[model samples]
Target: MKRKILLSALLLPAVMAFGQQYGGMWIPTELNEKEMKSLGMKISAKDIFNPDKASIKDAVVQFDGGCTAEVISPKGLLLTNHHCGYDNIQSHSTVENDLLTNGFWAKDMNGELPNPGVTVDFITDIKEVTAQILPGTENLTGAELTKKINENIEAYKKAQKTESYQTISVRSMYYGNKFYAYVIETFKDIRLVGAPPSAIGKYGSDTDNWVWPRHTGDFSMFRIYADKNNKPSEYSKDNIPYTPKHFLPISIKDKKEDDFTFVFGFPGRTTEYLPAIAVEKIMTETDPAMIAVRDVALKTLDEKMRVDPATKIKYASKYARVANYWKKWIGEVEGLKKSNAVEKKKQYEQTLISKNPAIKPTIDGLNQKYNEQAPYNLHKAYYSEVVRNSETLTLAGIYSNYIKAYEEGKMDAKNNEALKARLTEVYKDYDAELDAKVTAKILALYANKTPAQFLPKDFGMLKDANKNLGTIENMSKMSVITGRGNLNGIKTSDLNKLFENPKALVANLKKDPLVEMYGSFKSSYFETTDAKVTALQTDIDALQKKFMAQQMETDKDRKFFPDANSTLRVTYGQVKGSEPRDAVSYGYQTHLAGVMEKYVPGDYEFDVPKKLISLYNSKDYGVYKDKTGDVPVNFTATNHTTGGNSGSPALDAYGNLIGLNFDRQWEGTMSDINYDPKLCRNIMVDTKYILFVIDKYADSKWLLNEMKIVK
Candidate 1:
């Protein structure tokens, strides 16, 4: 027994050391300072995040509510992924001056283009409020407990003292075991400064998106503007560039493999603690269903885009949005299977139950609940994919809400204006002919895949002789949504006329074929599947929370980090590469030479600009060239990141910017569920490459003078 105890104690430290070396999205306040120092972090935890003074956290902001961005200069020069800023860029693009194709560089501050609805939020403070939130709900379970906690949060937010510019938001962590409130300041006026053309910014396009050894210069620049007092305000001509508390200095020093690195940003979501059964469900049923539906949509779009340049421009952003996840899901299924995540999870569960037999019931109950919820989960996935992917159906859903509001006597002038504005935006880049084709294919797939019991009452009417295309096309010709079949359906210009007569409009819309079809699908989902899924999910969540607590209690030696909930986090690791499979090794970085090797003239995905080629031939890389006499495009690191980590800052030992985090290796996409350091590596664009593009490529050297560059 003495020997066994000694051996167990020794093994505990080794296990913790392994965890420290690789996987974890840690909270900045609760950092493992000792381990970080051991891993070569020269700066202290306080230097990274200090609430009382200026620190690194002050420079990082949530870009437009979806991705992360870092301030690079005192004048509020911001850096983020090109894809994060793609929507704004596309918005400013025209057939004559297509910023997406020709790129854009603001020669002076006055030339910077304004983005109307874009905003960036800075997290000023984060404080743990678990003590206040959980005190009154000790005996409560399920909905009652949730209701009381929300009430407590509302009271806490009202009681806290904050500045007029600050807004308070509360988020649950560790599955409700802890809660943190964030004080955020949002800046309304953000403008685009510069971006590389698609040939450079999106070099590989969809083909090399999640792959390593990437040559894409996936970075863009924006600036934040504020009122005269440097406070958050809506856009106006009098506003000036806001001064930031602290900005990251760029490091152009040559880096090597095994160098220490860390990523700081807000990661959207992850399910790292789910049981084996739940992981299996995601791998087998959920991902495959979504993939199949998107496959049809992509094939149709790809064929259409190749034939018509106008269509290509209209659908470029939409295609990227769809293809991004379609490929990610494919890679995730392969990664989960390759990593044997489910089996490993089962073994871990066995150990947990072996350590404390009392928790066996909880684990078993959770697994059973997941098994019962699998079918409903699949139905939900198919429904969401079908509804969201079809533009016509999406518009139908919007009109459905308008009809409901008019019937409920809730429609006002403000709501009518908002509806008109939304419809105009939707129809701007919309193609009814293309949507009709995509809708017919996706609807057919949905009918074939989803179980008959869960389908809508008139689902059969969508299919003719087991082939949905002809029937769907016929409906499209006659329906008012697509405006394709006959001239009787509503046109884009005719929508405003319908809104003039509320009662008649509702009556006509209720009779419209597309609106009726959408209503059937939505009604069936809400009445039959969604309610059951929600009830089971509530029970499952309660059980999972209990299971999480039990695991913590049973394994006192283990260190736990909360799952990402779109909150600020810090994940540290080394700049390294991996052998994802036998006989297939990947390098740590890719150089400019790799770009030339992949270049193809007049190709949509691989075309290189003439000026860039001339510069490359002359070897005029300036100060951005690496020690090896080549410009480093991208590098791989072992940072655990996910969706919202896009455009996060990859920092060096002294907290200087070394690279910009963009994409994860394809195999590592599964890190959202199970993280393996060997298989998971986040891809980043080298800062040197960013500098080269700004100085040599775009000839925007004046903007570089605002930055603090360290050689």
Candidate 2:
């Protein structure tokens, strides 16, 4: 029988059974080939993972959006999540030149705009540093063990130093029972290459974020220019193409059930090892709370943005950003409860505890800690938003701490140096204009809410936004919002100019009693959060140890791996199809016709420009057709995925990339809660759709000529 759509095998407390299935930093060399093959993988893990074999390295890129990406060219080229690059493309759109609303094309290679903050990560090499670092250690106590391990690592670093990359990350997998050192190559020379119009790119938008039977060409392109030697270097016209060892071959055919496939990328995090009770709390209380808050925020933003054509364009990116993940969270939460993930985990924990009383009390202790911390989370989210709008006292507090430490000469040399470097580096990404707009938007949101629901309670400081904002009692009515208003529908740049009296940053930071209240709140918040986190760490670390202990006993049937601890992790699942929440079954099937179905003629979400609609109307569907059928634009695979899996490379049996995994069909949005092979399928745009858009629609042959396409 196929795995039921069960995120958790059974319900149980997480502190007991939930932390077991978490596989940490699994080396590509270590994926269970035999098991993977049984799950329908045609290629061996070694085939896809071996950097020396075929072009796997060139096929892998760390998708900053969430998943991983790879260089498919010797020239600066990148392939990643369509959703990941969506907002980046939208950011370049504006009133007269709205790329997002009308969609964007460089018209030529030179027209490609340099994206400011986007960065692509390249994995240079990964090594098992166990023997080199943990030569003789075997389960030592917490502090002493950490000290000894660090000392060992420090000596190893000093003795065997070779600098090919800037940050060498050591990830503990199998619950800190094993370790892998990944040396990453980072490049900031990435630029937006091409993207389909929103009609094709974001087709479904809010109506289809995490749902299935999905048809969205969610893909984007970026070019990366390396130094003359093709090594990592700063952006320079003097730089040359980064000739990569491999690039994925474009296929116009769809995948089949049990068809051999693989994916390579940096998956963010997962909690496959959480105990049942903890899962329950999240599914029932925590997820519900987050959903409730996010819904209000998204609805408010959506309603307010539709006020005018200009306002809609101004807030387009903002609305998408808020709604995209808000629906995802809601779906996951709803899916979790429906799939009975929490309950399954609970039962699993009970079974473990019944069999092993030695670990029961400790597990129970962990459960107690999770319960105590859960309630404060809602307040934390609400207040966290408040804190971001206020002059960022968290960073300021840290700075103050650093100053105090420096004055006392008590700061460690390494930490002091790191702090200074980080502070300086942060300013490069800081935009005062964006900040003012975001600050105003959030403050205005709080300012407009009912007094009882007010978060910071204005204290008569915030000029009432109720009078300041454009008032329309019905936001969803859409047509009533006539676009004209004072500060209500004003542009951010215009608002900054209007509020140019003494600058809002310094004004809010130095605003008399408010500043003092903020300082006091910041101090209290820091102290409280620090103490709680510190106390929580003790148990959390203990939980980690317990997780590691179980993982060490994997004796072959299944190697117990620890869940992700905000550290690194590697989860392995074959490319397979699924059926989800609704009776919808996602297949390796998608048609270009669906793209036009997502078009709504001029609605912001459904806007279709005449030139593009002309092409579609001309029945000029390009080479996006599949071998099995014609007009295949998007497809689904039985690949297990989640939030962190975005931008992951879905590959064929030859270890070649097939598609970029982005989201799962809505039915399987609950895939994280329970990976249902029947209903939980990961969705991706066919690689051919990408090529067609680039070569035909966008007409950027320079970028297309770089890729390796196999007909």
Candidate 3:
């Protein structure tokens, strides 16, 4: 029997029979222009994307490989979330000139700070090539099918006409039912132009992160430079500012509740089409376990950071990165339960099965498969969190990479040069005591939770050592390369020699109890990554793709958008408030008064600069104030967004920049797995407020003058 291949949902109409307003992240080239026009979009599809002409797509970029940014000036002035630029800001910071704390501004173009290795990519074109990608694969299954698809994709990418600086890649949509090839022009000489103090940019900090009614400014400015011909190039003193094909005009016009809004950028990932059983497992087992582990790590780091400023600086980035998803997972669990997402998914599945009984077996098998794999998945999650969260273990893993290089006889000049660079990267912000405390606690939790069969045999040694996690932690730290106790005495040349001799290197590494233990765990973990389990997952993935195709076919008339996979997409909605629970509601937008209300002097999270307070007191918002005479800080909308959408541009009907995407409301974090129109909302910093800070607070008039402002 031949496998059934369903129609591609990317070609479906945007209008839904259920009258659901703008929820899907649409491909600009494949968008239903009529639906957009009917829904009050002022621009045509071509106006958003036109390879042969300058359009909105030309202005958007994937910032630093993780976030999104938009060019706002012909000189390549880019706008993105402050947190997205946090690492760059922190790198330029020092004890004396703490840019993270005090902020930095370039007085002129010549003052802009160049960042090494930072790059921004713009999509030049997107072409639907499902036919080409999936040709003659109807009879294949599992890895064979995947291998063919990848091979086809590689062939297609290689055949594309691209410049030396441009690149091509293929992305799967609708699970694997559809494929779109993208041509991207990437600029490498991105520079830091200006950023507000942490007090303003990261205002409210972790405590208020992912929560609504937010007052965080959460905006940063940068510039992209190119060679004289405006082509992408490596950073050079002779490079000139990139003159973009298109730049978003800053809108300081008043925006009210129900204002039409859209976010255009990359959204990292979303499993909007998962089975109910998977959602349950994530909520019940994975989320809670991961959250608990992170909770322990956060407590340790927070305690140290509060007492010591140096420790605070050392752990700030790591703490924020960990806490972000920790808080999001907590909210996701809450939202999933609050909205009864599992029950809803089951209902949808029933409807799907009813529409086509052919899918019933697939759906039933998926539920059983998810249930059986739940523990194994949770075990993997726990192990991942334990190793990744522990600085000592992370260092061990880093050294393990070098050991492999030595054993392979690949630790020559190039690899050694890279290893030296890696060492510098590792030890720069490392805190040994903090790592030891975090590692000890987290490893103990993992041992307590993980099943015995999954535990490495060498872990028995830890159990025999009086069940003392600290003992294991201390032994590792004292002997590992990153251990402060051992660090100062060990020279760089010593590490160089270790890499030169595989036998001596193994001997030296074996002397460290933690290293040896980690080696055992890694080896044992690899042993347990059963091929059968992998085959089961591969079967599940193939089933999922079929299920996705069936879903599109069953709901052919309804708008079926693909899930986010770190691809450029356009999601539009209205500025709206969410009633998370009965009798409690959040307004759509926050104001300067709210910032002042939350202000606490000398408090790490809530403190604002005195200059900001004075401006608020004087109502010095200039023309950026809303109709009510308050500067809008941040606003919420029904736009469907996820991780990589951070720093995406929030555009108005006319495609003018009004806000910068930074986060989603806490209750809406579940939007990734399940989207609820009432509860789901993305939070964005109002461009007016960004302008107010740049022009008034930061006194960045020159930067303001560079942007194209529209009232």
Best by lDDT: 1
Clashes of each: 1, 54, 0
| Model 3 ranges with Cα > 4 A deviation | 1-22, 32-39, 90-98, 226-230, 233-240, 302-314, 420-434, 458-470, 473-505, 530-533
Better of 1 and 3 by TM-score: 1
State every prediction's TM-score relative to the real structure: 0.91, 0.74, 0.89
Candidate ranking under lDDT, highest first, comes to: 1, 3, 2
For candidate 2, the lDDT comes to: 0.57
Cα lDDT listed for each candidate: 0.87, 0.57, 0.83
TM-score of 2: 0.74
Better of 1 and 2 by TM-score: 1
| Collision pairs in model 1 | 477-485
Write model 1 residue lDDT over 144-229, tens digit each, in one string: 99899999999999999988878999999989988999999999999999999989999988778797668899999999999999
Per-residue lDDT tens digits of candidate 3, residues 481-591?
645434335543355554555576566676766677678777777677445457667767877888888888887667778888888999888777767766555677788
